[model samples]
Target chain A: MSKITSLADLKKKRDELKGGLDIRVKAIDPDSVVQVKVAMATCGIASGAKTVMEFFLEQLERRNIAAIVTQTGCMGYCYAEPTIEVKLPGQDPVVYGFVDLKRADQIIEKYIKTGELVDGIIPVNYQTIDFKE
Target chain B: MSKYSMHLLVCGGTGCHASESDAIVCNLRDELEAKGLMDTVQVILTGCFGFCEKGPIVKVMPDNTFYVQVKPEDAQTIIEEHVIKGRKVTRLLYQDPVSKEMISDSKHMGFFKKQLRIVLRNCGFINPENIDEYIARDGYQALGKVLSEMTPEQVIKEVRDSGQRGRGGGGFPTGLKWEIASKNKADQKYVVCNADEGDPGAFMDRSVLEGDPHSVLEAMAICGYSIGASHGLIYIRAEYPLAIARLKIAIKQARNMVCWAIRFSAQSTVLILNFAMEQEHLYAVKKQH
Candidate 1:
């Protein structure tokens, strides 16, 4: 409501607004939050990116973890339908293929929460980092 | 913001406000409250959503849905048809100017598809004038991190390792400069931020001070600490009045943070910037990662 008067007051305000702040900050600066991108191209949709994306949205927040889940064009992995990319803060973006709900859960538990790599990783076909994508 | 079943982001930019986005926000919140859905739904009055051609943008979060050209009267239908029934308001959906095809998700729309948000973090997500919104997003965490745990030499080394260059036309290494200043032994050293980019096209500094002012202040404090300077000064242009106002608010907000215990006399002053074309397209990208 006004200028923050003390450290205690600032901490209180931060906690009070943590939920909304997480939703907004995860998007603007996803470095600290888990960044998930669903492949939503025609091929991806045909494979079930829609279900995978929805499952991510409902489950990530339900698990009380902050994440930004958005749809993106094909990452050129057509064979792997319903592919998703997970980028942890300070880490390079990792693409996972054949993502059903079960794999999605494992991703949340092992990769996102525990920082342990999960299975379903697809090797990059080209030099994407050089393109500054 | 947390675990909300739905979030309605209404554009409160100059254009969308003229289109009565305020009424849309009020009505949407009313509809949610009337239906006993306030606990699950959040109505945020955000800045321009970048799609000025389709002003009065209303974005729904968690599902990543976009409703464009919304009216005050569309509130009931949005809540009932879209929010409650899980159906989209087809009439309010954004149509591509070229293809004339409706784009429901912003990620798929060309207007937003090619975009990446790095500098303009909180432009449309939070009320720029509100200090609380700024603090909510870990605004001063960096300053806290630097002062509590880092020595001046340690901070300078980290900056050197990060390879951060100047933000202006000249990409000078920031850490090298700080290391130089810290080595200069003086009773009263100084950290000066030369913010006066008088050129018409240079506006990154101005927009950041306006939208996410606290971040600039935090960085300034960190610089002051790293340079072993007790004083921080900002040289800003006066032509930009909004930047000036927001900088004052940011400075005031930063002063109230828990800096007294960590660092002494870590205060800052301001400057200005300008960029031409599409200045109000600040809210183009939703936090879609």
Candidate 2:
């Protein structure tokens, strides 16, 4: 939990996690932990994704919400700062926009815990073509 | 069918998030619960849908209706009209930037109409964390087929024939690189996925890792198999914490497949701001090629 200053230290930390770690880290089972992805690309950081990420980690830990919070790169939505993607098992993943600390707290409490959708959603302006087999 | 029948997918990509995608999600859930349809409607937050120009995107599954630039205030109407009554939110649908015509389906949309999405195949479609969704989309089938049906040489030949250049800036022939590494007489050769995608305006690698991480895993394993290497490394930057996390999940899922013992090493690469020198070197290399 200390500040990681060096690459060696980061590698060591990652190695420790990888060593003897259960494969359950991947959300294979539906009942497992929810995966929360925060966009931390340079654009996202400029828009305050770092703060949003920290908020999610802290809140999830404080509430014991057994979720995995991580960082991602530019989602090409530079207009929407501090974006986040949440994935629950056995369901689809959703992306939320314009996240501040307050909204982050709400997401954790309502959506992560109770499976309730909150405000701060970007309406779909772009269409994504999904190929299903 | 009455319970959890409707799935609401909200765009949580950075762009839409800045536009209040989170608030929209919260309000939508509140309205659903208030309408006593919480159990019947499952609201999920997903990654980017790739139409960044108009964000705060939302998609209704089974029907695949795209709603664009949705504000928190619009959440109630979306839930009331779309979820409750099963009507498309036409006003929120994406309109062509040029034609200004509301395009409901993504396939006909101009942004993605020309993109060939082999790498981005599973993105915006499946729950990234769910292995089943990935598997259902023939995600691991490529790996399984490569592992069981094709030999290292054959796999290398197929990739070489496919003309898939390294997505990395170098654009080197991927198969040739694998062949070089495979041909080298090293006791420990490595198949490294340059997830260290360091382009300024580029999120191609990041999206692949985030949305369809298994593809990268499959591709990396294929690289490993083709290169006669048992280990793989993803040189990702610490700056991309979400990509790292998703890559971590993907590596874990891939390891469970009972194929080769593929090891994942995630490391941060040095970022170069002005690629003037690199670009010069690239031109020189291209001339030789």
Q: Say which candidate scores most in lDDT.
A: 1
TM-score of 2: 0.58
Residue range A18-49, candidate 1, lDDT tens digits? 76665554443445677788877778988888
Please give the lDDT score at residue A51 for candidate 1. 84
Tell me candidate 1's TM-score on chain B. 0.73
iRMS of every model, one decimal?
10.8, 18.1
Q: What would the per-residue lDDT of candidate 1 be over residues B1-289, giving only the tens digit for each residue?
A: 4555456778766567679998999999899989888976788876566776687888876555788888899999988776664567888998778877777878788877788866676766776666677667666656655554566699999999999998766899999988988888998765676667777766666656556666666777677777756556667777656666766756554455443312223223343211100212111211111
Q: What TM-score fits each model? A: 0.59, 0.58
Question: How many residue pairs clash in model 1?
Answer: 5
TM-score of chain B of 2: 0.79
